[model samples]
Target: MKKRKLVMGTFGGLLLLFGAVTGFQTLTLESRQPAAKPTSVEIDKDKALQHLSEAITYQTISYEDRTKFDFSEFDRFIEFLQNSYPSIHEELALERINNYALLYKWEGTDSSLNPIGLTSHYDVVPVLKGTEENWEQEPFSGTVTEDAIWGRGTLDDKIGVIGIMEAVEYLIQEGYQPKRDMYFMFGFDEEIGGEEGAKAIAETLKNRGIRFDFVMDEGGAIVENMVPGVSQPVGVVGVSEKGSATVELTIEGSGGHSSQPKDQTNIGRIAKAISKLEETQFHAELRGPGEDLFEFVAPEMNLGMKYVFANKAIFKPVIEHILLQEPASAALIRTTIAPTIFQAGEQSNVLPEKATAIINLRLMPGDSLEEVKSFIEKTIDDKQISVSISGSEATKVSSVDGWEFSTIQQAARNVYGNAVIAPYLMVAGSDAKHYDDVSNNTYRFLPVQITAEDLNRMHGTNEHVSIDNYLNSIKFYAELIKEANK
Candidate 1:
């Protein structure tokens, strides 16, 4: 009886100690967000709204097939910029790469300081044929309503191009010059992978031996209902972007009549392999930018969440399990698998001799193409199935310890005062990946307040942005330019 009581007492005391350590960590966690340097700037709302609206009409669409690109539309868009922003065209030295990608340099007085690049793409994704009818306004109409600006490029992400231009033009008008140089690059083919546009620009810049202090691209945005335990909106800055890998799983076997089908067919084998992969996904752990995300937000979380995140060392499994429950959150911790296409037998009655499936994967920072391909082979564990993977590895993780990231975080907080700005991993690929070689730090973020729905509408039908959001985006850019220079 005494031994049983002693064991029970010991267990209870251990629990108390565990709780104490967690409580202390939670209490001591500091907010990683930098002090806000909010700047009040006035924008001519009507003119800015008109510019974004008109900009969307250009139909500068990026298609996977390079030959299909309408260079005429791209030329028209370039002319539009020259006509609209005279101050920018006059002050900044603009050059065209491959006749579409626009690179502008605003020479700084001090040559010792390296330049910072602000980048985004003007090429919008082509609206799917059948989905055009679903739009409230024409997909390329550039309709400006009293409350919102309706069009395709309003969101993903001609907004970034126009916003930066407007900010620079405004600054030029206000007699603002910088000691540090600035570069503005707008890619023409970002949606289809920036091989010809951003990649070419980076190569050109690299050949020139021009290295950058920092480069900013369009990515994470101010979002609501994204981070749990934080009631207010959270602004996420992407310090590392996930690599997109395309995996092809193929199987070949003998064909047979439907009535005399073999016990195991190619289609059946491929399906089973996919099933195995789904059952065994990549291991999920809290590390890299994903871990950094929680560290920044834990201090602001409610007591219950704060306790769990603060004591993550003890509750890592629990935290990972909970995060894996939601797709959005699960994506943060590990690499993701998505089967995009399946090509099997065409005839209904004939058993096909071959089966092929293409899987799309977003790789976390540490996950490499070779590692991912090996993982797929091992998980599937079928000798007949062959796996081939091809794609870029994850980009280099940028610095969060200094003003490189804090400049962006502070700029965001200054505009969206209530948002919790934290560093995170961008699951979607962006042009920032191409600039990695030329820039010391590449940060991806679009300065706009967006919702879950707004994200969906990026490459979907009915894509539009509220006038207020558009205006705020301009303000955010203006603040970032001034804040970064300071």
Candidate 2:
């Protein structure tokens, strides 16, 4: 009886200690959001809206086939910038890389500091051939209503180009100068890949021995409901971008009449391989930027969520499991596999001798192509099947502890005072990745409040930005310049 009583007391004591530890962690978890002093500058509302609308009228679309690109439209875009912002053209020294990418250097009073760069791609994706009719406004019409500016490129990045240009023009008019040099780098072919546009600019500056203090580009936006626990709108900055890679699986075997086919044919083998891959997907581990994301947001979340996240040492496995349930959350934790193309039998009757499948992957940081290939080979476990992989690895993670991030965070908060700005891993490819070597740290964040629907509209039909969102984006750029130099 005495032994039983002792065991009960010991169990109660352990539970008390556990609760005490978790409670202390929860109470100590503090908000990482910088104390943003809200400030506003009067930007011409009518003129700003008009400028973005007019900028969208020019169709600078990127095509997969080089021959389909209309360079004349790009020419018009360059002309439009010249006519729209005269002071920017005359005051800042400009160079056109590859006759398309624009690089503007704004010299500062202090030569001791390294220059900063603001980059965005002006090129927009081509509207699908048949999907044009799906748009509420014409795909490239640059439609302006009472509340919004309707067109392509408004969200994907033309807003970024025009926003930066407009902000500089405003500052120039105000006779403001910076202590550190600033470069406005705009790429033309980011939609397809920035090979010709962003790549050339990085190469040009690299050969000249010019290194940036930090380079900012268009990426993650401010959105609500992005994380399950947090209620306020969260603005995520891309500290690192996941590498995009292509992996292909192929099988070749003997072919015969369909009537006398063996139990395992080429199509059957490839399909079985795909099934195995799906069943044994990439292992999910919540570390790196994904872990950082929760750390910053934990303090802002409700008590229940804060309790779970604050005691991460004990609740990490539970948190990872919960995160793995959602597709977007799962992406933050692991590499993803998407089967894009599958080719098996051409004709219905004859058994095919060859089968091939192509998969598109977004790799997490520290995951190499070679390791990915080995995992695929092991998972499939079929000697008859051959696997091939190709693509770049993930970009190096940037530091959130530096002024580079705090400047962006502060600027974003100056305009969006109520938001929770946090660092996250970008799942898509952008021009920022090309400048990885040229700059010590590269950051990607498009300053706009967007929704889940707005994400689809970016490269899809009916892409548009609300007039207020458009205006606020300009404010962000203007504030970013002021914050960076200060």
Candidates in order, TM-scores: namely 0.97, 0.99
Off by over 4 Å in 2: none
What is the number of backbone collisions in each predicted candidate, taken in the order shown? 0, 0
Q: Candidate 1's C-alpha lDDT?
A: 0.91
Quick one: best TM-score, which candidate? 2
Q: Tell me the RMSD of model 2 versus the true structure.
A: 1.0
Error of 2 at 311 (Å): 1.0
Candidate 2 per-residue lDDT, tens place, 1-486, comes to: 999999999999999999998899999998899887876677999888888998899999999897999999999999999999999999999999999999999999998999999999999998889998999999788889988898999998899999999999999999999999999999999988899899999999999988998999999999999887799999999999998899999999888789999988988988998899888889999899899888889999999999999989888999989998988999999999899999988788899989999999999999999999999999999999999999989999998889999999999999999999999999998999999989989999999999999999999989999998988988899999999999
After superposition, the stretches of candidate 1 with alpha carbons farther than 4 Å from their true spots are 1-9
Question: lDDT of all the models against the reference?
Answer: 0.91, 0.93
For residues 1-486, write the lDDT of model 1, one tens digit per residue. Answer: 999999999999999998788889988988887777566878999899889989999989888888898989999999999999999999999999988899999988888988999999999999999988899999999999879999899999999999999999999999999878999999999998898889999999999999998999999998887888988788888999998899999999889788998888899899899898888999999899999989888888998888889888989999999999999899999899999999988899999989999999999998889999999999998988999999877899998888888888888888888889988999988999999999999999988898889999999999999888888888888888887788
